[model samples]
Target: MSMNTFPIIRVVTKLLIPYILLFALYVQFHGDYGPGGGFQAGVILAAALTLYGLVFGLEAAKRVAPPKLMQRLMALGVLIYAGTGVATMLMGGNFLDYNHLTHDVWPQVLPSGQHLGIFLVELGVGVTVTAVMTMIFYTFAGRQHIT
Candidate 1:
Protein backbone atom coordinates (compact mmCIF):
# COMPACT_ATOMS: atom_id res chain seq x y z
CA MET A 1 0.00 0.00 0.00
CA SER A 2 1.24 3.44 -0.85
CA MET A 3 1.56 5.77 2.13
CA ASN A 4 0.73 8.71 -0.10
CA THR A 5 -2.83 7.44 -0.34
CA PHE A 6 -3.42 7.90 3.41
CA PRO A 7 -4.81 11.24 4.49
CA ILE A 8 -4.59 10.27 8.16
CA ILE A 9 -0.79 10.06 8.01
CA ARG A 10 -0.55 13.45 6.42
CA VAL A 11 -2.88 14.97 8.93
CA VAL A 12 -0.98 13.55 11.86
CA THR A 13 2.34 14.63 10.43
CA LYS A 14 1.08 18.17 9.97
CA LEU A 15 -0.12 18.22 13.56
CA LEU A 16 3.07 16.82 15.01
CA ILE A 17 5.70 18.76 13.08
CA PRO A 18 5.25 22.00 14.98
CA TYR A 19 5.41 20.32 18.36
CA ILE A 20 8.57 18.52 17.34
CA LEU A 21 10.21 21.76 16.35
CA LEU A 22 9.17 23.33 19.60
CA PHE A 23 10.62 20.52 21.65
CA ALA A 24 13.84 20.82 19.70
CA LEU A 25 14.08 24.46 20.66
CA TYR A 26 13.40 23.60 24.27
CA VAL A 27 16.13 21.01 24.35
CA GLN A 28 18.53 23.35 22.61
CA PHE A 29 18.06 26.28 24.97
CA HIS A 30 18.07 24.18 28.14
CA GLY A 31 20.90 21.92 27.08
CA ASP A 32 23.77 23.56 28.95
CA TYR A 33 21.80 23.37 32.18
CA GLY A 34 20.50 19.85 31.67
CA PRO A 35 21.15 16.62 29.83
CA GLY A 36 19.89 17.53 26.34
CA GLY A 37 22.14 19.62 24.15
CA GLY A 38 23.21 20.44 20.60
CA PHE A 39 23.42 16.86 19.29
CA GLN A 40 20.06 15.76 20.62
CA ALA A 41 18.30 18.95 19.63
CA GLY A 42 19.82 18.82 16.14
CA VAL A 43 18.62 15.26 15.62
CA ILE A 44 15.14 16.18 16.81
CA LEU A 45 14.97 19.12 14.42
CA ALA A 46 16.17 16.97 11.54
CA ALA A 47 13.59 14.31 12.35
CA ALA A 48 10.80 16.80 11.91
CA LEU A 49 11.98 17.63 8.40
CA THR A 50 12.43 13.97 7.58
CA LEU A 51 8.92 13.16 8.77
CA TYR A 52 7.51 15.88 6.51
CA GLY A 53 9.43 14.51 3.56
CA LEU A 54 8.20 11.01 4.23
CA VAL A 55 4.58 12.09 4.49
CA PHE A 56 4.63 14.54 1.62
CA GLY A 57 7.55 14.03 -0.76
CA LEU A 58 11.29 14.57 -1.14
CA GLU A 59 10.69 17.52 -3.47
CA ALA A 60 8.48 19.13 -0.86
CA ALA A 61 11.15 18.73 1.78
CA LYS A 62 13.69 20.32 -0.52
CA ARG A 63 11.36 23.21 -1.03
CA VAL A 64 11.08 23.66 2.72
CA ALA A 65 14.86 23.50 3.16
CA PRO A 66 16.72 23.80 -0.07
CA PRO A 67 20.10 22.15 -0.53
CA LYS A 68 21.78 25.47 -1.18
CA LEU A 69 20.36 26.96 1.98
CA MET A 70 21.33 23.92 4.00
CA GLN A 71 24.88 24.09 2.63
CA ARG A 72 25.17 27.74 3.55
CA LEU A 73 23.73 27.06 7.01
CA MET A 74 26.27 24.30 7.55
CA ALA A 75 29.11 26.72 6.86
CA LEU A 76 27.55 29.46 8.93
CA GLY A 77 27.10 27.10 11.89
CA VAL A 78 30.74 26.03 11.81
CA LEU A 79 31.80 29.62 11.57
CA ILE A 80 29.74 30.54 14.61
CA TYR A 81 31.22 27.69 16.66
CA ALA A 82 34.82 28.40 15.68
CA GLY A 83 34.35 32.14 15.82
CA THR A 84 33.35 31.88 19.48
CA GLY A 85 36.68 30.34 20.30
CA VAL A 86 38.54 32.91 18.28
CA ALA A 87 36.59 35.68 19.94
CA THR A 88 37.76 34.55 23.36
CA MET A 89 41.34 34.53 22.12
CA LEU A 90 40.97 38.03 20.76
CA MET A 91 39.61 39.12 24.13
CA GLY A 92 42.96 38.22 25.67
CA GLY A 93 41.89 34.90 27.14
CA ASN A 94 42.71 31.31 26.16
CA PHE A 95 40.66 29.75 23.40
CA LEU A 96 37.00 29.04 24.25
CA ASP A 97 37.28 30.83 27.55
CA TYR A 98 33.81 31.83 28.66
CA ASN A 99 35.11 34.25 31.29
CA HIS A 100 36.45 36.53 28.58
CA LEU A 101 33.13 36.53 26.77
CA THR A 102 31.94 39.41 28.93
CA HIS A 103 33.07 42.94 28.25
CA ASP A 104 32.70 46.16 30.21
CA VAL A 105 30.58 47.65 27.48
CA TRP A 106 28.32 44.57 27.15
CA PRO A 107 24.67 44.99 27.89
CA GLN A 108 23.43 43.79 31.27
CA VAL A 109 20.25 42.12 30.07
CA LEU A 110 22.03 39.08 28.73
CA PRO A 111 23.16 36.20 30.87
CA SER A 112 26.61 35.87 32.37
CA GLY A 113 29.60 35.29 30.12
CA GLN A 114 29.72 31.53 30.67
CA HIS A 115 26.06 31.06 29.91
CA LEU A 116 26.22 33.30 26.87
CA GLY A 117 29.24 31.51 25.50
CA ILE A 118 27.67 28.10 25.96
CA PHE A 119 24.50 29.27 24.25
CA LEU A 120 26.34 30.45 21.15
CA VAL A 121 28.43 27.31 20.87
CA GLU A 122 25.42 25.06 21.33
CA LEU A 123 23.42 27.05 18.80
CA GLY A 124 26.11 26.52 16.20
CA VAL A 125 26.33 22.80 16.90
CA GLY A 126 22.57 22.39 16.68
CA VAL A 127 22.40 24.23 13.37
CA THR A 128 25.20 22.27 11.75
CA VAL A 129 23.86 18.93 12.92
CA THR A 130 20.31 19.69 11.76
CA ALA A 131 21.54 20.74 8.33
CA VAL A 132 23.82 17.74 7.93
CA MET A 133 21.18 15.18 8.91
CA THR A 134 18.50 16.79 6.78
CA MET A 135 20.84 16.90 3.81
CA ILE A 136 21.65 13.24 4.29
CA PHE A 137 17.97 12.37 4.20
CA TYR A 138 17.51 14.42 1.05
CA THR A 139 20.48 12.77 -0.61
CA PHE A 140 19.21 9.30 0.10
CA ALA A 141 15.67 10.11 -0.87
CA GLY A 142 16.69 11.61 -4.19
CA ARG A 143 18.77 8.64 -5.24
CA GLN A 144 17.22 5.75 -7.18
CA HIS A 145 18.44 2.58 -5.60
CA ILE A 146 19.42 -0.37 -7.79
CA THR A 147 17.06 -3.22 -7.02
Candidate 2:
Protein backbone atom coordinates (compact mmCIF):
# COMPACT_ATOMS: atom_id res chain seq x y z
CA MET A 1 0.00 0.00 0.00
CA SER A 2 1.00 3.61 -0.55
CA MET A 3 1.49 6.03 2.35
CA ASN A 4 1.74 9.34 0.68
CA THR A 5 0.96 12.79 1.90
CA PHE A 6 -1.06 11.69 4.88
CA PRO A 7 -1.96 14.83 6.78
CA ILE A 8 -2.60 12.93 9.96
CA ILE A 9 0.74 11.20 9.81
CA ARG A 10 2.51 14.47 9.17
CA VAL A 11 0.89 16.07 12.17
CA VAL A 12 1.68 13.12 14.35
CA THR A 13 5.31 13.13 13.31
CA LYS A 14 5.63 16.81 14.05
CA LEU A 15 4.17 16.46 17.49
CA LEU A 16 5.91 13.27 18.58
CA ILE A 17 9.40 13.48 17.13
CA PRO A 18 10.65 16.20 19.46
CA TYR A 19 9.47 14.42 22.55
CA ILE A 20 10.81 11.08 21.39
CA LEU A 21 14.23 12.50 20.67
CA LEU A 22 14.39 14.27 24.00
CA PHE A 23 13.57 11.06 25.83
CA ALA A 24 16.08 9.14 23.77
CA LEU A 25 18.86 11.56 24.70
CA TYR A 26 17.83 11.37 28.30
CA VAL A 27 18.12 7.61 28.20
CA GLN A 28 21.43 7.74 26.40
CA PHE A 29 23.07 10.10 28.88
CA HIS A 30 21.36 9.16 32.10
CA GLY A 31 21.68 5.43 31.70
CA ASP A 32 25.29 5.32 32.90
CA TYR A 33 24.17 5.19 36.53
CA GLY A 34 20.84 3.47 35.94
CA PRO A 35 19.27 0.51 34.16
CA GLY A 36 19.50 0.20 30.31
CA GLY A 37 22.62 2.04 29.18
CA GLY A 38 23.85 3.49 25.89
CA PHE A 39 23.05 0.56 23.64
CA GLN A 40 19.43 0.48 24.62
CA ALA A 41 19.28 4.23 24.31
CA GLY A 42 20.77 4.05 20.80
CA VAL A 43 18.14 1.50 19.75
CA ILE A 44 15.39 3.69 21.05
CA LEU A 45 16.81 6.74 19.33
CA ALA A 46 17.14 4.82 16.04
CA ALA A 47 13.60 3.56 16.35
CA ALA A 48 12.29 7.07 16.84
CA LEU A 49 14.11 8.31 13.77
CA THR A 50 12.89 5.34 11.77
CA LEU A 51 9.34 6.02 12.78
CA TYR A 52 9.68 9.64 11.66
CA GLY A 53 10.87 8.51 8.27
CA LEU A 54 8.24 5.81 8.00
CA VAL A 55 5.39 8.19 8.59
CA PHE A 56 6.68 11.35 6.91
CA GLY A 57 8.70 9.85 4.04
CA LEU A 58 12.44 9.73 3.47
CA GLU A 59 12.81 13.21 2.03
CA ALA A 60 11.35 14.92 5.06
CA ALA A 61 13.44 12.78 7.35
CA LYS A 62 16.52 13.62 5.31
CA ARG A 63 15.94 17.31 5.93
CA VAL A 64 16.55 16.55 9.59
CA ALA A 65 18.77 13.48 9.35
CA PRO A 66 20.66 14.04 6.13
CA PRO A 67 22.06 10.83 4.70
CA LYS A 68 25.51 12.23 3.95
CA LEU A 69 25.84 13.87 7.35
CA MET A 70 24.61 10.73 9.04
CA GLN A 71 27.15 8.67 7.14
CA ARG A 72 29.96 10.99 8.17
CA LEU A 73 28.85 11.01 11.77
CA MET A 74 28.62 7.22 11.80
CA ALA A 75 32.11 6.90 10.43
CA LEU A 76 33.38 9.43 12.94
CA GLY A 77 31.78 7.56 15.80
CA VAL A 78 33.46 4.31 14.77
CA LEU A 79 36.74 6.13 14.30
CA ILE A 80 36.52 7.42 17.84
CA TYR A 81 36.05 3.90 19.10
CA ALA A 82 38.88 2.47 17.02
CA GLY A 83 41.11 5.45 17.71
CA THR A 84 40.90 4.71 21.40
CA GLY A 85 42.09 1.17 20.75
CA VAL A 86 44.81 2.38 18.38
CA ALA A 87 46.01 4.90 20.92
CA THR A 88 46.33 2.17 23.48
CA MET A 89 48.32 0.05 21.02
CA LEU A 90 50.53 2.97 20.17
CA MET A 91 51.23 3.34 23.86
CA GLY A 92 52.71 -0.17 23.63
CA GLY A 93 50.05 -2.82 24.08
CA ASN A 94 47.38 -4.88 22.26
CA PHE A 95 44.00 -3.52 21.18
CA LEU A 96 42.09 -1.80 23.97
CA ASP A 97 44.70 -2.75 26.54
CA TYR A 98 43.90 0.08 28.91
CA ASN A 99 46.97 -0.64 30.93
CA HIS A 100 49.07 0.83 28.16
CA LEU A 101 47.61 4.30 28.76
CA THR A 102 49.04 6.28 31.65
CA HIS A 103 51.50 8.98 32.67
CA ASP A 104 54.10 6.24 32.49
CA VAL A 105 53.56 3.14 30.33
CA TRP A 106 55.20 1.02 32.99
CA PRO A 107 53.55 2.62 35.98
CA GLN A 108 52.99 0.36 38.97
CA VAL A 109 49.31 1.23 39.44
CA LEU A 110 46.54 1.43 36.84
CA PRO A 111 45.76 5.04 35.99
CA SER A 112 42.31 6.60 35.68
CA GLY A 113 43.20 7.19 32.00
CA GLN A 114 42.32 3.58 31.30
CA HIS A 115 38.81 4.06 32.63
CA LEU A 116 38.41 7.29 30.67
CA GLY A 117 39.51 5.57 27.45
CA ILE A 118 37.00 2.74 27.86
CA PHE A 119 34.19 5.21 28.53
CA LEU A 120 35.03 7.15 25.40
CA VAL A 121 35.02 3.97 23.32
CA GLU A 122 31.64 2.94 24.66
CA LEU A 123 30.21 6.39 23.87
CA GLY A 124 31.46 6.08 20.30
CA VAL A 125 29.77 2.71 19.87
CA GLY A 126 26.49 4.18 21.02
CA VAL A 127 26.73 7.16 18.68
CA THR A 128 27.58 4.99 15.67
CA VAL A 129 24.79 2.54 16.39
CA THR A 130 22.14 5.23 16.64
CA ALA A 131 23.16 7.20 13.55
CA VAL A 132 23.86 4.21 11.30
CA MET A 133 20.54 2.53 12.09
CA THR A 134 18.69 5.76 11.37
CA MET A 135 20.54 6.07 8.06
CA ILE A 136 19.69 2.47 7.14
CA PHE A 137 16.02 3.06 7.80
CA TYR A 138 16.04 6.19 5.65
CA THR A 139 17.70 4.29 2.80
CA PHE A 140 15.15 1.53 3.12
CA ALA A 141 12.32 4.00 2.91
CA GLY A 142 13.81 5.27 -0.34
CA ARG A 143 12.35 8.77 -0.51
CA GLN A 144 8.75 7.85 -1.00
CA HIS A 145 7.47 11.03 -2.67
CA ILE A 146 4.09 9.68 -3.63
CA THR A 147 1.17 12.04 -3.68
Candidate 3:
Protein backbone atom coordinates (compact mmCIF):
# COMPACT_ATOMS: atom_id res chain seq x y z
CA MET A 1 0.00 0.00 0.00
CA SER A 2 1.15 3.51 -0.79
CA MET A 3 1.39 6.31 1.76
CA ASN A 4 -1.27 8.24 -0.06
CA THR A 5 -3.62 5.31 0.32
CA PHE A 6 -3.61 5.68 4.09
CA PRO A 7 -5.05 9.02 5.02
CA ILE A 8 -4.79 8.32 8.71
CA ILE A 9 -1.14 7.42 8.54
CA ARG A 10 -0.33 10.45 6.47
CA VAL A 11 -2.16 12.77 8.81
CA VAL A 12 -0.69 11.26 11.95
CA THR A 13 2.82 11.24 10.58
CA LYS A 14 2.58 14.86 9.53
CA LEU A 15 1.36 15.83 12.97
CA LEU A 16 4.04 13.92 14.81
CA ILE A 17 7.12 14.91 12.84
CA PRO A 18 7.44 18.29 14.50
CA TYR A 19 7.27 16.79 17.95
CA ILE A 20 9.88 14.20 17.06
CA LEU A 21 12.25 16.86 15.80
CA LEU A 22 11.63 18.96 18.89
CA PHE A 23 12.39 16.02 21.14
CA ALA A 24 15.60 15.38 19.28
CA LEU A 25 16.68 18.98 19.87
CA TYR A 26 15.77 18.72 23.52
CA VAL A 27 17.83 15.58 23.87
CA GLN A 28 20.78 17.22 22.19
CA PHE A 29 20.73 20.41 24.26
CA HIS A 30 19.67 19.01 27.62
CA GLY A 31 22.01 16.04 27.54
CA ASP A 32 24.43 17.39 30.13
CA TYR A 33 21.61 17.74 32.61
CA GLY A 34 19.60 14.64 31.72
CA PRO A 35 19.85 11.12 30.36
CA GLY A 36 19.87 12.06 26.68
CA GLY A 37 22.99 12.91 24.68
CA GLY A 38 24.40 13.44 21.21
CA PHE A 39 24.29 9.82 20.12
CA GLN A 40 20.75 9.35 21.28
CA ALA A 41 19.58 12.62 19.85
CA GLY A 42 21.23 11.86 16.53
CA VAL A 43 19.56 8.51 16.30
CA ILE A 44 16.23 10.00 17.23
CA LEU A 45 16.55 12.63 14.55
CA ALA A 46 17.54 10.06 11.97
CA ALA A 47 14.64 7.89 12.93
CA ALA A 48 12.23 10.74 12.43
CA LEU A 49 13.62 11.42 9.01
CA THR A 50 13.54 7.77 8.15
CA LEU A 51 9.93 7.64 9.14
CA TYR A 52 9.29 10.57 6.87
CA GLY A 53 11.03 8.81 4.01
CA LEU A 54 9.07 5.65 4.56
CA VAL A 55 5.78 7.46 4.50
CA PHE A 56 6.53 10.05 1.87
CA GLY A 57 8.78 8.12 -0.49
CA LEU A 58 12.54 8.18 -0.84
CA GLU A 59 12.47 10.76 -3.62
CA ALA A 60 10.55 13.14 -1.42
CA ALA A 61 12.99 12.62 1.41
CA LYS A 62 15.91 13.30 -0.89
CA ARG A 63 14.26 16.51 -2.03
CA VAL A 64 13.96 17.61 1.56
CA ALA A 65 17.57 16.73 2.44
CA PRO A 66 19.70 15.79 -0.51
CA PRO A 67 22.56 13.30 -0.33
CA LYS A 68 25.11 16.00 -1.05
CA LEU A 69 23.85 18.01 1.90
CA MET A 70 24.06 14.94 4.10
CA GLN A 71 27.71 14.38 3.10
CA ARG A 72 28.51 18.00 3.87
CA LEU A 73 26.79 17.75 7.22
CA MET A 74 28.86 14.71 8.14
CA ALA A 75 32.09 16.50 7.26
CA LEU A 76 31.06 19.70 8.95
CA GLY A 77 30.21 17.93 12.19
CA VAL A 78 33.63 16.27 12.39
CA LEU A 79 35.25 19.61 11.63
CA ILE A 80 33.33 21.24 14.46
CA TYR A 81 34.33 18.56 16.93
CA ALA A 82 38.00 18.66 15.91
CA GLY A 83 37.99 22.42 15.61
CA THR A 84 36.86 22.75 19.22
CA GLY A 85 39.96 20.88 20.32
CA VAL A 86 42.15 22.89 18.01
CA ALA A 87 40.67 26.07 19.39
CA THR A 88 41.51 24.99 22.93
CA MET A 89 45.09 24.36 21.89
CA LEU A 90 45.30 27.72 20.18
CA MET A 91 44.14 29.26 23.44
CA GLY A 92 47.22 27.77 25.11
CA GLY A 93 45.54 24.84 26.75
CA ASN A 94 45.83 21.09 26.38
CA PHE A 95 43.75 19.33 23.76
CA LEU A 96 40.04 19.13 24.53
CA ASP A 97 40.60 21.40 27.51
CA TYR A 98 37.19 23.03 27.67
CA ASN A 99 38.27 25.17 30.58
CA HIS A 100 40.13 27.37 28.15
CA LEU A 101 37.10 27.92 25.97
CA THR A 102 36.38 31.19 27.71
CA HIS A 103 39.42 31.97 29.80
CA ASP A 104 40.23 35.11 27.89
CA VAL A 105 36.79 36.63 28.13
CA TRP A 106 35.79 35.70 31.67
CA PRO A 107 38.02 33.73 33.92
CA GLN A 108 35.15 33.28 36.33
CA VAL A 109 33.11 31.56 33.67
CA LEU A 110 35.40 28.59 33.25
CA PRO A 111 32.71 26.14 34.23
CA SER A 112 30.29 27.72 31.87
CA GLY A 113 32.82 27.40 29.10
CA GLN A 114 33.17 23.75 29.86
CA HIS A 115 29.44 23.31 29.53
CA LEU A 116 29.44 25.23 26.27
CA GLY A 117 32.32 23.18 24.90
CA ILE A 118 30.63 19.94 25.78
CA PHE A 119 27.41 21.14 24.20
CA LEU A 120 29.16 22.05 20.97
CA VAL A 121 31.03 18.79 20.88
CA GLU A 122 27.85 16.85 21.47
CA LEU A 123 26.02 18.84 18.83
CA GLY A 124 28.77 18.04 16.35
CA VAL A 125 28.49 14.37 17.09
CA GLY A 126 24.71 14.49 16.80
CA VAL A 127 24.83 16.20 13.44
CA THR A 128 27.36 13.75 12.05
CA VAL A 129 25.39 10.75 13.26
CA THR A 130 22.09 12.04 11.97
CA ALA A 131 23.56 12.62 8.55
CA VAL A 132 25.29 9.25 8.41
CA MET A 133 22.28 7.31 9.60
CA THR A 134 19.89 9.01 7.22
CA MET A 135 22.30 8.45 4.37
CA ILE A 136 22.51 4.79 5.19
CA PHE A 137 18.75 4.46 5.30
CA TYR A 138 18.46 6.24 1.99
CA THR A 139 21.02 3.94 0.39
CA PHE A 140 19.22 0.83 1.51
CA ALA A 141 15.78 2.11 0.73
CA GLY A 142 16.84 3.17 -2.74
CA ARG A 143 18.15 -0.29 -3.46
CA GLN A 144 14.92 -2.03 -2.62
CA HIS A 145 12.55 -3.10 -5.44
CA ILE A 146 9.03 -4.32 -5.06
CA THR A 147 8.52 -7.85 -6.34
Highest TM-score, which number?
1
Question: Which prediction has more favorable lDDT, 2 or 3?
Answer: 3
lDDT of 2 by residue, 1-147 (tens): 225668887788779988988887777666655665567777888888787777766677788888888899799888988998999899888998876667564456534665556566767877898888888887666755669
Candidate 2 lands at a TM-score of 0.72
- Pairs clashing in candidate 2? none
Candidate 1 lDDT tens digits, 29-135: 99987789888999999999999999898888899999999988888889999999999999899999989888454677777788889999999999999999998
How well does model 2 score by local distance difference test?
0.76
Expressed as tens digits, the lDDT of each residue in 1-147 for candidate 3 is: 138788898999999999999999999989999999989999999999999999988898899889999999989989999999998899889989998888457656545668879988998999999999999998898885869
Off by over 4 Å in 3: 103-111, 144-147
Choose 1 or 2, whichever is better by TM-score.
Answer: 1
lDDT for 126 in candidate 3 is 96
Candidate 1 differs from the real structure by a C-alpha RMSD in angstroms, to one decimal, of 1.7
Candidate 3, residue 128: Cα displacement in angstroms equals 0.4
Measured on C-alpha atoms, candidate 3 has an lDDT of 0.90
TM-scores of the models, in the order given: 0.93, 0.72, 0.90
* Reference-based lDDT, residue 38, model 3: 89
